[model samples]
Target: MAGWAAAAALLLLPLFAVQFTDGVNWEMVDFSVFGAMLLGAGVSYELAVRMTGSSAYRAAVGVAVAAAFLLVWINLAVGIIGSEDNSANLMYGGVLAIAVIGAAIGRFQSAGMTRALSATALAQVLVGIIALAAEFGSTAPSFPEAIVLSTGFFVALWLLSAYLFLKAASG
Candidate 1:
């Protein structure tokens, strides 16, 4: 539940940042959003493993998520169904890959440690938002617009994370 809430907050961050300043780039925003989602997944996975005391299940879930991310990366890399912006595609794909690696590590390591790492991931998202806001200055009307956009985005992300967490927890 906490993990989902964190992810929800992260998803809203980009829109908020964007509304505050037009200078925000999609790559950075996407990186932050995906990073948060991955972090949430790790947290949920760690909790599940801790409760079940089964490393096999942890590894299985990690691998499955990683494999799915890899497929998405490939699709984006090849421009199969979306924009062909190589830089954005590569940036997003690399971030997802890193997340997968982190998940893999979490699966094999101590659950408590993995949970800590997941918390760090969530912190990174908040830090990114602060950095973006700082860079843009807080004087503009766009600041409010950004906040609204981010709120919506975060809410959606939170719901998604919560759903995923519940599903993973139950399984």
Candidate 2:
């Protein structure tokens, strides 16, 4: 209840800003989506906490869920190192979507964990490569080093998550 209330309060912050100043301008749809994302993150972490017994697994679950929420929210807000509408950035969402769906499909078993983690890691790589390609194809005059760095950063995170899952599965 505290988590949900805190998330709700955060979501309402922009609205309060709008009432007092012009600096904050967010549409209803923006509020709805962002609110949903926050709520979803809280719910996910709560579920992970309830379902997982191992501390390592719980930590991984917490991080992975938070990462997915952040990745999606950032891409939706400002794109993953580029324009928000850039299709190449959708791969981040794809990685997360697979994580959820793959878990369900695998019945949350050890072998399934391995496959799902590997798939997510692969998706992260694909996101980086595609984002790089998208940047090159754009008519924008100069390349942004930040884009490359961000992609590399995310790829490393996914790889680490995969390794964690593999270790958990083996143990």
Candidate 3:
């Protein structure tokens, strides 16, 4: 749990920086969405840990998700991968693939745990859509606002993945 919290905090730093630096005031809905995701991830990870009793499995899943997301994020950030076209699609597809792989692995090792992870992953996808909608709505946000908002979403995901990692490590 602590590890997850730390990871969440670390992931949030970039968003906080963008918000503070750019003087963006976050809306209540934005905060609520991010909070929900954080809560969901934590709950799912805890449930999976309890069900599987295999810390290694939990950690592997957590690390895999985090590493994959980080890799893509870095690619986008450094201009190594995503350009203008299809960036969103590519990122979404990558995330979906990771979730599917995680689900498959979980199913093979522990059905209950896999289901929990899958549920969390599904929630993540929904949240991503919501974030995207929020971003592109009537009043399109400024670059800073968009950055902060997206960062918040990623932070929540990192926290959830960290939770799994810690559970695996401890077990």
For lDDT, the strongest prediction is 2
**What digit string (tens of lDDT, one per residue) describes model 2 on residues 1-171?**
887888889888988997999877888999999988997899877886787676656666666676677788878887764577666666677888888887778676545755776677677767677767666325433246656666667666656666666666767
Note the residue pairs that clash in candidate 2: none
TM-score for each of the candidates: 0.29, 0.78, 0.40
Q: Compare the candidates by TM-score and give the number of the best one.
A: 2
Task: State in Å the error of residue 60, model 1.
Answer: 1.2
Q: What is the lDDT of residue 99 in candidate 2?
A: 81
Worst window of 10 by summed lDDT in candidate 1: 79-88
Candidate 1, TM-score vs. the true structure?
Answer: 0.29
Clashes of 3: 1
The per-model lDDT (C-alpha) reads 0.46, 0.71, 0.51
Q: Going through the candidates in order, what is the number of backbone clashes in each? A: 4, 0, 1
lDDT string, candidate 1, 17-127, tens digits: 877888765576577646755675667566656765554445544544544444353444342212334232233344345445665666534442344234334443453
Rank candidates, TM-score, best first. Answer: 2, 3, 1
Clashing pairs in 3: 55-168
